[model samples]
Target: MSSFARHRPAQPSLASVGPNKLTQQSLAKRLLFHSHPTDELPPIFLSETLPPELTAEVYDFIALALRAYINPWWTKITRYDKEFLPQVTHILVIVIRALELRIQRLNIPALVFHDIPTILSQHYADYRNALSKLSTSYASGGAASLPQLFSQMQPHTAILPDGKIDPEYFRQVFDYILRVCLPLEDHEAEAERIIVREVIVKVLLDDVLPKVTQPWFVQKTILDLLGPPAEGEYMGPLSAPPSSFSFHNLLIIILSVLQSFSGACIALIHAYKQAIITIKLVQHSPPYKSSTLPPQTGHTGPPPASPVADQSHTFVSPSSISTTTSTSSSTSSHPLQQWGSISAEPLTITQVGGNYAAPGLAMVSEVFSTRDRFSSNIFHIMLTMLSISITSFLDKLLPYLLLNTLCPAFILNITRLSKRTLFPNGYPGPQPQEPTLEEKAEIRARLVAWRGEGVLSYFLPLILGPRPSETLGAAVDPLSSAQCNTHLLVLLLDRVLMGLFPELADGLGNPSNS
Candidate 1:
């Protein structure tokens, strides 16, 4: 027998001792054996059917060995075969569970967190190397064995079982890795943490996303995790309820994706576009409509007169009305200024969307319902991505910008409506004052301009006419800002095109804008 096998640690008898009881003993022996500079490492016994305790121990040994004993040799290590990589994935399933459950009884060390990223980075590198070799070998081998070579090129059966990718599986893996890395966000460890994030992001964008049946679904799910919960509905993978801490972790991952991957801009934008359609469908679905509608008053005509109506009957000059409006407007233009000022400073997930803190970021307001924190986070993410896409990738994004801003339906969805207008079935909440004559005249002029623009312009009023939603927090109100920002972004894109390609800009203008 080989010297390595001659000194192999004997497996403890299962009848006399449980696997959990021997964890420290196993770790100590593995660490001692691997620490020697000249001793050959023992063969790793990895199998899909390995017991959970054995799997965890194997991974823990690999992790500790890398950190404590293998650093110098790892750079020169032979590349693992594709089959080996998938078995590594099986080992990871156990680590993922421990991290997810916050299990404290595991004999895993702190260094293991650091080592996990290192192992993943190396595994993917080997995977890529194997693919490169496979392609090269196939190219030179000729058509005699093309069918067999093609079969070899198919994604590993272990990773893509039944030729289908499970995006949630990857998501769980990613979430756990990032959650473990959160404590390393400080300056001293930030660089190392960033490297790990970049590696994971590269795999996500280049490898995983391209293979998925619907890449958009994966993107939407990630954003959904980072955002607030859906109203009257749970939002998550159904593994856990939405929480602030998880949202914060997810946000970090997303920010890393944006920073690391050049193609993420396009992917996220497409996801946002898909989100617009999905949310609109959900909002109009029977469940949302029924849940959000105010109680019936049984009267459809004009509202019954009250003492407030009696006060309104006392005539006030249009000039006085204009003066008072201007004064109030000049003093403050915030939609919720009457209620109170809101902080614009960056907020922790805890301070995001509600009075009570959960596990993630939320925004709340005393003036309006702060229930839809997910909607709020989604909006902020959309705005950040739009700004980045427009400013940085304008050339590639021009087509998207045109569709979002010029398409009447797209515009209508992004703009907020008055509470009464939006929930037409009934609205018992605060009602905004009626428009003054000047305001009415302005509206009419705007309508006329819209009509002059052409048939499509008729829909612009619905898009732009609604007052902002009364919801006060960012988590609660996202669409109003989206409407304004998207309009500006398209206009900016137009001007940039005008400078670069005047003919293109000329064709891009809306009739009203022209």
Candidate 2:
């Protein structure tokens, strides 16, 4: 070799460097050449370490990120990204769950703007604009034209051949929910989909209904929803072949929808209670009740000098006269001046009588309305919501809870479940015989007690057997009423379907048997 070539330094190969380059010593040496280790390490997320002053903005950012991740409307992100779904679910669980905790740790209000995210400001603005437009329509064209806004959305579409269902009227209900009521971000979140519904409901009860004042708006929407689908829609394939939709198809969906409304109902009931209290207070107050009394002499202005008495009037000592005049003026204003000083003066009997003719009549009218119209409307909405929640036990929820979520999960993972749960209280061995009326009554009573004791007390013992008494039974606390009402609604569907064929099923078996 030439002396010049031999003088060149040898370059290092991959084998010479070895696979341990990531070791601390080598990594430090590599990193030292470029930058400090702290600088090289991933920059601590700036947002995670933010100061308290920017907490609201942090929440906004999180909500926005959640919206992006969820793509609630399917417009923000594509649904084709199946692998990303789990990530979204976990993120949503964090938002739905961990967000409050994080906020608390940061020392921020747990409920900001009533838990309405700043990211939804645009959406709310749109909602307000739409509401205004709908209000205008109601005012101009009347209540009959109110549905015009929603009607713009293509009328319910049925899946021509197989989708024709009777009692399966979720097309409208689901539309109201997805399009209007509670539009969720994730599809799999149908089980937990409640945020939008709650928002819509609060707006409807507190904001929309109270201010709207249109009777038709309330009446039509309530009747339309609570009753059945109207004509020309969901009648199915307008042709020679006869077909009809059954309510059974959408029974679970409707019950779920109603169950979601329970919060709104509770709010309404609270308001109703407050209203009753207020009305009672008003009735007891001077405004609601009327009484008449004889006019009394005025203390001011020399008792309005009469023509005969004017000549006979005599002026006494200046000190005595002046003292009496000051006393009279101090005690009351003159009646002649009372007209101009109506606001300052105590209302007179004549004034009260005049008010009775006008405003009192109004109070009377309101009192009459409270007895029936107000109660009926309030109860109708409340009972409707309550019924939905109450009946959920018989619907699809119980069976699914028994068969899918709880039972299968336990039986598959925990081998000891069957012995403790089955055989004794539920299922297998003893064939269930049809009960007589007296036995059925006792069964009903027992079920009612279970409900009163709370869902956990009721369900755990049934699922885990008497062992649950050892753990969850000590002073049984009730589960959330809203949660309890959300049981699957499929079971009641059978009864509904059977009831539809009352000609055959009218008295075949007791309705309680369901």
Candidate 3:
């Protein structure tokens, strides 16, 4: 070898480095650096089991990186980073999930319950503040619309390469944010918690829904969030399949949204009614009466505990109570359990009963059965919302009543579901097993309970309440307002009754003729 060549230092080769000596550290940074494609997720994200250590590092890095993008005080990032956000969001979903799993496996409920939500709340506050600023700018004509304003204000985290908002991305975001926001236990200040919830409602209502270009995509997203309609499968009354979002969650969210609403109740109702109808179509059943557990014949264990003696305070069903306990346990064990584990046990009969029930029955309202505490809560909130809008804000109700096509398709679905419920054998298909006497009795009880506790308990009085104009007694002309409000109330009553009793033909006109 030549003297010059021999003088050069020997370089390390694969064999010289030795496999054991070579460190495989921080795979996330390496993966994120090289993978810039927006169309698909990086390999680390696609892996069934992600590296926990690396994932935690990636999550921290992402949280830091996203701070600049979501920060309210700094307007430094004005333009969207289209390529980075979509890919980063994919990584985020995976990394957040992996970190959640790791935290769970380590049996750290505090991190999952408190830290995650508080951290996420802080992030959401930043976003909300920035969004508020953006909204002000938009009002002054800074952008063409809300969608455009958001796209310009922050990196398009939910936007695709084709420059369209990806509904799935927002769904994941909503699911994650919502999962953390649940659990009635107060982890953060009340204001912070409210901010987090309001952000979700605003994004979904003000930003995502209106921007979606696809025809049915908005409706589909809403339905999925509210628990997709139950297929004609045989599910136990207590069976609640795990989902990313659920009807129970939706009710809580709607109630939260209402806290922020001044007069947007009609818009909120219009947005959710279809999803609610679809959910009720198949899930509708009578409220379950509390019964004593049958004594076990072959058991040598302590007898099952009796129901709580405080009949004045209605408790959620046993299954729901169990679900809350299970959720707490599962939060420390399973990652998927975090998404849709919230149950209705937190709701009390007094909270939802309001002043609608008779004075005598009001105190014993809990004695009656409800289809489910969550479903009952949904009706109560909806009734309150409708009442508020009709009596408090006639203008909002009248416009929605005239402009929207609320019932044509839903009425058809109502008829079909009614047929199935009233006459299961009427349709041509495999025969369903006839319900037992106990089942039939339970159904009758539910119907009676619904009559007393359902929307009709409040709604009939509201619709028939001294015409809305008289209730408001505002400067608006009473004659014109009365006519419009009455018309709107009747229409709303018709729709509400359809949901309450699918078999009822003339909802307001005649209850007995059907």
Candidate 4:
């Protein structure tokens, strides 16, 4: 027999003891040998059946162990003790498979969602700390231990039975990694891209899109979350109202546009700064040398006539006259003489030729033309109107959006309304008796008072607040606050159309169902 088999205790024959006693002892031995020991073994064997709760607890424990310990090692440990690794891996796989089957049979949605998130969060925390330590150690020229590497990867193994990660958990991890570790080259580029893409896509489909299904609710929630659109007392210009469509589709479009705009703006600012630096460098360059001008010819008028008649010009020898004239001309034309003749110090020309003018003109013209084109586009006009209206709505609704700040009166009114809509008679759970008409009236009065206060504080801001400053001047000429207000109005109209008559929006805009 193998050494392992030899070490394992032998089973006693049924004849040696009553069957019940024999079975009890066998179970006790098995329980003792299990990775985790439980106190419920006696009930499990004495009754000849395992309690449902006990089975569930055992499976949960095993699942936790597999998720926390076993799976992490799969991607790590290039070399491990073969015998030990195989044995541990086999045991873990069996436990995991068995738990998966049990979970499937149970089909408990709430338990699955709740427990899975808790497990994932715990694993994520562990992995996060482990990854940090590993990175620090590696940076210090120390090699990562196998266990450390395994720990760093453990969170990734919390996959569903179908081998997919939990959608919500995946999104949480993806966003966390992007925010925290993405700047580190080693973490960001490795397996992160695939992981992020998968999680984001899944979350959009599962979590975010579902919320968009109810248009009015979505609009209200979005207004609550992001604050309302920036309109004043008057809503701006509007086109056809939005058709009836899924709220999720509209939110997706809105979010996409916001993200795109933000990214574009950042890129533009970076480019602008770089262009400015380049222009400065060019302008500061030293001036080029001018080529030498050709020397000027000297004029010698005919020699002055001699005073004596043909005793002519025994005045001076011709050679002497010629030599004296040449010397005088050379001295007058010398650089030192030219320098002495100048009265004003030479002006330094700081500007470079072929530099600023052409490029500056071109840039200005291009920017203006682009702005004009964008301003003329109907889509841009619409988007601006939408943004403004949304902002204005948020401004007016801010007070009501606060859960804690809402008046007790408003809460009572909401409770009454909820009772009328949902419960009819009263709430499901045992609670206080039905309210009297007088009490209800008092609640209503309080709600009205709170509502008035909310409207005053919130809506007043929209009317009285200063306009947003223009980000770009005439060069870019993006939509102004007023224009954006107008666009927001149009967007609301679009929302209305989509919300009330989705078939039309679907036909017009071709928005995705998701």
- Please give the RMSD to the true structure for each candidate, in Å: 31.7, 31.1, 27.6, 37.3
> Which segments of candidate 3 are over 4 A away from where they belong?
16-207, 212-514
TM-score of 2: 0.16
Name the 10 consecutive residues with the lowest summed lDDT in model 3: 346-355
Error of 1 at 188 (Å): 2.6
- Judge candidate 2 at residue 20 and give its lDDT: 45
After TM-score superposition, what is the CA distance of residue 342 in candidate 1 from its true location, in Å?
30
Q: Kindly list the per-residue Cα lDDT of model 4 for residues 1-514, writing each as its tens digit.
A: 6998989988877677665454443222232234433333322111212245443334333333333333356447544423432333333333233223222222122112222222223322333344456656553454764233433333222233332334554353333323221223423343434433453445344433333333233233333554443443235576877777999989999999999999989989999998777555445533232111111111111111321111211112232122222111111110101121111222111111111122222233233332334333333345345545564332223212332243345534554444343233322223234347675444333322221233356542232222211211221121212222222222222222222221221222222311
In model 2, where do residues sit more than 4 Å from their true spots?
1-5, 18-34, 37-102, 106-109, 112-380, 383-514
Among these predicted structures, which one has the highest lDDT?
Answer: 3
lDDT, ranked from best to worst: 3, 4, 1, 2
TM-score of 3: 0.19
Clashes of 3: 2
Superposed Cα deviation of residue 364, candidate 1 (Å):
36
Q: Per-residue lDDT tens digits of candidate 3, residues 1-514? A: 7997989998888888855358653323333433432222234333344343444444334433333233332235544333343344343454344334333222222222322232222222323343465546544654444334323433333444334445554344333333332323332234334333444445443433343422133223333444423343224467767878779999998988887584467667875997576445424432212111111111112221322122211111121112322222222221212322123221111101112212212111122211124444455456556655554233223223322332334434554444344334432224334457676444333322221233334653332233322322211111122222222222222222221122122211222321
Candidate with better TM-score, 1 vs 2: 1
lDDT, model 1 = 0.31
Error of 2 at 474 (Å): 50
What is the lDDT, from 0 to 100, of the residue 136 in candidate 2? 64
Clashes of 2: 24
